[model samples]
Target chain A: MRVAFCFDLDGTLTEEEILPQIAKHVDLYEEIELLTKITMRGLITFSKSFKLRVRLLSTIPIPTVKQTVNTILVNRPLQEFVRNNKSDCFIVTGNLDVWVDEFISREYGCAYFSSRAKVEGDKLIDIEKILDKQEAIHTLRNSYDLIVAVGDGMNDCSMLEQADIGIAFGGVHEPVSTLINIADYVCYDGLALAVLLKSLKQKYGREN
Target chain B: MAGKIDTVIICAAGLGSRLGLDMPKCLVEIGGHPLIYYLLNVLYDVPNIRMVVGFKEDIVMDCVRKIRKDVVFVRNPAYTTTTNSYSLYLGSHDLQVPFLNIDGDMYISRDNYEKFVDKIVPGEDLIGVTLSYTEDAVNVLLDSENRAIGFSREKISNYEWTGIAYLANIKIRKEGLYIYQELEAYLPIQTEEISCFEIDTPQDLEYLSNKMGHL
Candidate 1:
């Protein structure tokens, strides 16, 4: 059965969180710091933070950010495992347009939903069209048999709640308490996640 | 691990008394060259490899001292303590880490060894991975999922000795089971299928040679 698997990008896949990457890329050190503080305090939504942050990083060479994201995502050997178990899985994130579009298509063949980046001419615009991850999962439910969501940030809490099983990746980032408390399991790495999923499919899928 | 097993522990300390050999059977010449010399070169190419040694301590130490000496070594001074379990226990006590254990008497082509060793389950503690019903080998009991329920090297009426390898974690390596009991005391932990094996006689070597093309 196909389990719609939603994923958070920053701490879930890339070892480098998105804001840090934005901070390093655009040289907006002070803005990144302040934005991080607001996000940490739960004062600003991830959408607002992401849009405002990327707006600051709009001047970064698009190719450089895309390349960095691709490099980090592609080093993973999870492609074969995905192929072996692709009957179920999906990627859900709050990352902006070109980064998610190209990165997901090339590295992970699974369908993904991410925030759209407004572009003008050759430069990406600073503002992103924000879509909550929960909204992403809701859209996927029309086509999937089950949904399994994985993420860390507070922004991921709603999407995780929408899924059949939510997994919190505490190894990389401190997940929101709601996600942590409600998640079916918390995995340290892809290794643990894969093993758990394999066991789950065997025990609970189809015939059961 | 990308592969199944967390680590592969080659049992190399058995003294080759049958061959009238001065060195361990692992170090004995299979094709005019020491078997272990070939084994190490092949095993090291795989991701995670370890060694458990016992008899003729200096020889085992010296042979591995030069090449990739970083491998973990578990020594069994009581290698002759009436069972393979003793040697396995002594050598395995310190390794709280999970691993696979191979008998010293057998030989496998590099290709086959990788196929078996690389596919061993991670974190699961199992005694052996024996085969289907056959009187030729010790009838290894199997549960519904094919995990090993029991291992008896004696010619049993049921299961066949797979002659393959076994992957076990630190929990299974817990000291207590006498080698005489073999894998009898350790089979209740299976949450999934345990693969099996069948290597016990000189003829078995001939069989594998025929199967794997004389490695």
Candidate 2:
């Protein structure tokens, strides 16, 4: 049986949120951070919050955003685990592909389903489509027998709930209570998370 | 089996009326720490742990959250009228992998506990037994193969039940039955010698307190 590992990009794969890092460059860090917190707590809807946060960040130069994305630290152990198991790993994020594509997709060369952004010749424009994480999981479920999802925010609730094994990661931020409630396992350290993923792979990976 | 023992269903929903404690038995302090603290510390290698809480669940959950934020809790609302079997049933009802079923009232030396964990082989069901005698101990009758054929409140055999077991994936038929009674249906249970004790009365608590300095 095939098994897939789904990861959330922002809080699960990176130490910082991509949008907040971009917000710092445009001097809207505090405001965007508040919005991010509210959205993560499920106080506000994810689609509305994503549009608002993207609108706040759209004015920044594309090069500046790319440079900041490069500077944002990836969770090294998780990156290594995904790299070793790239065939069955997928990044499911609500972040725009135009912003994170270079660092996350191109750097790792891993498959991802992310929000699409309409870019008009090097100028940041508008969101073309917001990726529904649950839908992505459903699509992967057709091929894989078991899906293990890891995330920390409220936007990840649906994907986590849909997965066979849901792990609420608190490596970047303390996972919201809603996500934790649905998670089968909760991990606080990146190394521990990596170990858990490896153990799960041994247990459910197709080769096993 | 799909995996090694990755989950532990700790039945902490019982009300320890004999111990004269206002809190649940799992929350009773041995030496400034809850009884679960030692068990969880030793079980760090196991990835999934579900705690079934009922009487004073909030308090027990609070203590557990402080020690290990990863623990998942399943509340048994009928803790007042139910036995540990019901709480065990609630915890392991939906699990698909092998798990260790333990009572929250149990306290053992770290060395012996690690030995018990080491003895657990994948896909094999095991029950922990000890030669130590207690009037309330659940006695077991084992065949020559060391498979338990009978369990009784009276001294029916030389070994006493230790309230710990490693179970394979099997659905438990919960009909107000004790965990042992349900387990008896699946006879030929493998037995292991492990040093463990349960804190059910004031005397057990006092005995644990005396051993606390060594633990």
Candidate 3:
């Protein structure tokens, strides 16, 4: 059976949340914190919140954001799993493609889907599109027999719900209750998540 | 043949209403620590631990996570109408390996449990039986060879099913029967005597609390 493993980028893969790291690096801490409060209070949708964060973060040059993202630590075991299964792995994130493109390619060397950016040479620019995570699963469904999704945030809810198997990972923090309620399996440790990914792959991938 | 059984499936989804604690029985505090703490303390060596949770699962998951970060939480949404066998079935998903299945409410002697795990042989299923003591016990009818031929509640037997076993796979051919009743189809399976206490009622909890010194 052909299987696809989709991962959320921010808190799930990176040890530190990418946007927060970028915000802290460029001294946008207060602005980002206010936005986070609003987002947590459920005043805005994920797409809207992401777009707002991206637009606010656009003041920093694209290269600086990419550099900050690359400098952040990642869950090594999970990263290695994606590296080994590059062909079957994917990064489904709401972050702008322009910022993470270079970093993800350099780190994981796997296919990725993210929000589109209309960049004009490193200056603050307008938002083009915000990615809906479920779209990634829909696209992967056309090629793979089974889709296993892993994530830790509220935005990953639809993507996980659409996948054949959903795993709520708490490598950085506890998975939200909504995601946890629907997850097929919930894991806390990075090594355990990696092991679970391998086990699931073996079980479903061999059936075909 | 099986190698080492690395997976442990703990069924903690039941409402545990019979215990009248208004909480999952596994979370019941015995001597300050929850019942599951005793079992997990002994199962420290296991790498892949799957816990089937429902009926106040958030509480169970939160408590278990503090002790073991590697546990795989499997949701049993139909827990209200299902039995522990169904929870076992859910927990076994995607696992093609042999595993040790234990009920969540069992308080097993740590030393005895370690030895029981040590005695497990590859490719052979081992049933755990304790001395008949619970008010509503499923007694195991064993042959001279110590192989379980049938399970009976009416028959007076020395051993009662402790709801623990090292299984190759769970084959639920028949539905609605309790786990042991379903195991009748695979009769004459091997049995082992272990020192454990199953808390099913207030009396059982009190007995365990008083018998803690002896255990």
Task: For candidate 1, give the DockQ.
Answer: 0.01
Count clashing pairs, candidate 1.
15
What is the two-chain DockQ of model 3?
0.72
Off by over 4 Å in 1: A29-34, A37-41, A73-80, A126-128, B1-215
Better of 1 and 3 by lDDT: 3
Lowest lDDT 10-residue stretch of candidate 1 chain B: B191-200
DockQ of each: 0.01, 0.10, 0.72
Q: What is the lDDT, from 0 to 100, of the residue A18 in candidate 2?
A: 77
Candidates' chain A TM-scores: 0.85, 0.96, 0.94
Error of 2 at A143 (Å): 2.4
By DockQ, is 1 or 2 better?
2
**A183: Cα error in model 3, Å:** 1.2
State the lDDT of candidate 1 residue by residue for B57-128, as single tens digits: 556655664555445444554566535555565444434456566665555456656555445555655444
**Off by more than 4 A, model 2:** A206-208, B1-24, B41-102, B114-127, B131-137, B142-154, B165-192, B200-215
lDDT of each residue in A1-208, candidate 2, tens digit only:
6889999999789988778878998799899989998998999999999999999888887777888888888888899998888889999999988788888765566899999998887777999999889999999988999899999999999999899888888877778988877776666667757866776677556353
Kindly report which residue pairs in candidate 3 clash with one another. A1-A208
How much of the true A–B contact set does each candidate keep? 0.00, 0.07, 0.72
> Distance from true position, residue B95, model 1, in Å?
26
Model 1: what TM-score?
Answer: 0.48
